[model samples]
Target: MTETLTTALIEMREDDVLAAVRAATEAGTSPAGIIAGLQAGMKTIGDKYEAGEYFLSELIMSAEIFKRALAELGLDQSAAGTGTRGTVILGTVHTDIHDIGKNIVASVLSANGFKVVDLGVDVPAQRFLDAARENDARVIGLSCLLTTAFPAMRETIATFAAAGLRDQVSIIIGGGPVNADLALQLGADGAGISAQEAVILAAKAVEGGVA
Candidate 1:
């Protein structure tokens, strides 16, 4: 890992990290190495969140900064399946436009080398199914910030089952209004309480395992 880049990223200095990524890419840094640095940065942010030193706004800002820098690193989206890591389809459930948490999870997964297909906000159940099917994603990440969107989460799972894709994709739910109990009630495979937990659980879910 690039220690300097990782350290600067932990400090949440977007410009510094971007410079490091650019320099590394130009200097022949391997894609895996650059991704490791990004993942380290995400882990730092996750630590801050767990320590109550970072808020949702901070998390979202950091995610966007990393995504922009990663894009500059020449990551091949078309080669998403080239890595040993499995694919993930992430989205903010239908009617839920709050995507801060969802974006954090997606960024973390991306840094960890998981091919993430982010469906963005207000993603309907059918869209999730379509993305999962199209990408052959191993896991489906659902984020909800409102209790009203809770039904959308359940509907998504139902749609997957109806399409005979439920067993093929593990469902993970997260965000402010979500909890382990609700996740279980909704028939989800797992629930993530924080960005760190999301990364851990997502990796496991993709492997057809859980934490």
Candidate 2:
């Protein structure tokens, strides 16, 4: 972790984190290195959220802060498409309008060399499948903030299988109310508890396609 940036991010100091990111970028720090630091910070923040030390508001605010840091570095999703390692289709599951986590995943993935097709929030299963098909994406990320959206995730996976693309593309799930067991139960490739882990999962999923 970029110690300064991670500390500022853990404390939710937006200005300080941005300053650190800028300083690091100017010092020729690789975007991947900088993102690793931010990712560590995000993991800690997520831990706090899971421990009940942080509320939904803090979790949302932290994601917003991270998004801004990415934008400051020009490595946000806008810069994620050039010379991509692989394509990933990402979105909030149907009936789930929350997008904080999904946005963070997109930013992180983009900064880490992935091309992300973000489908935004409340996206249907067919939309996810269609985007994956259209982009030839090898990895799909599903984010859900509400229990109500769980069914949609299940349906999304089922839709992929029904389309005969289940074995073709890897699917990963994340966000509140989702866990590793739930991911297995849904028959997904994996579950990401944090943005950094999501990157790892996506990369591995793409590697699976390559192999």
* Top TM-score prediction, candidate number: 1
CA-only RMSD, every prediction? 3.3, 5.1
Clashing pairs in 2: none
Estimate, for each residue in 86-191, the C-alpha lDDT of model 2 and write its tens digit: 8889999899999988887786676456788999999999999999889988899999999889899999999999999998988999997889999989898899
* Off by more than 4 A, model 2: 1-83
In the predicted model 1, the residue pairs found to clash are none
Model 1 off-target regions past 4 Å?
22-28, 44-58, 76-84, 208-211
Per-residue C-alpha lDDT of model 1 across residues 1-211, encoded as one tens digit per residue: 3787888878888888888887887889887787778767777887787788887666777767667766776655335222357788899999989997887777667655578889999999999999998988878899999999999999999999999988778899999988999989999988998876787787787665543
Candidate 1 global TM-score: 0.77
| Candidate 2, run of 10 with poorest lDDT | 75-84
TM-score for predicted model 2 compared with the true structure: 0.66
Q: What's model 2's lDDT at 23?
A: 93
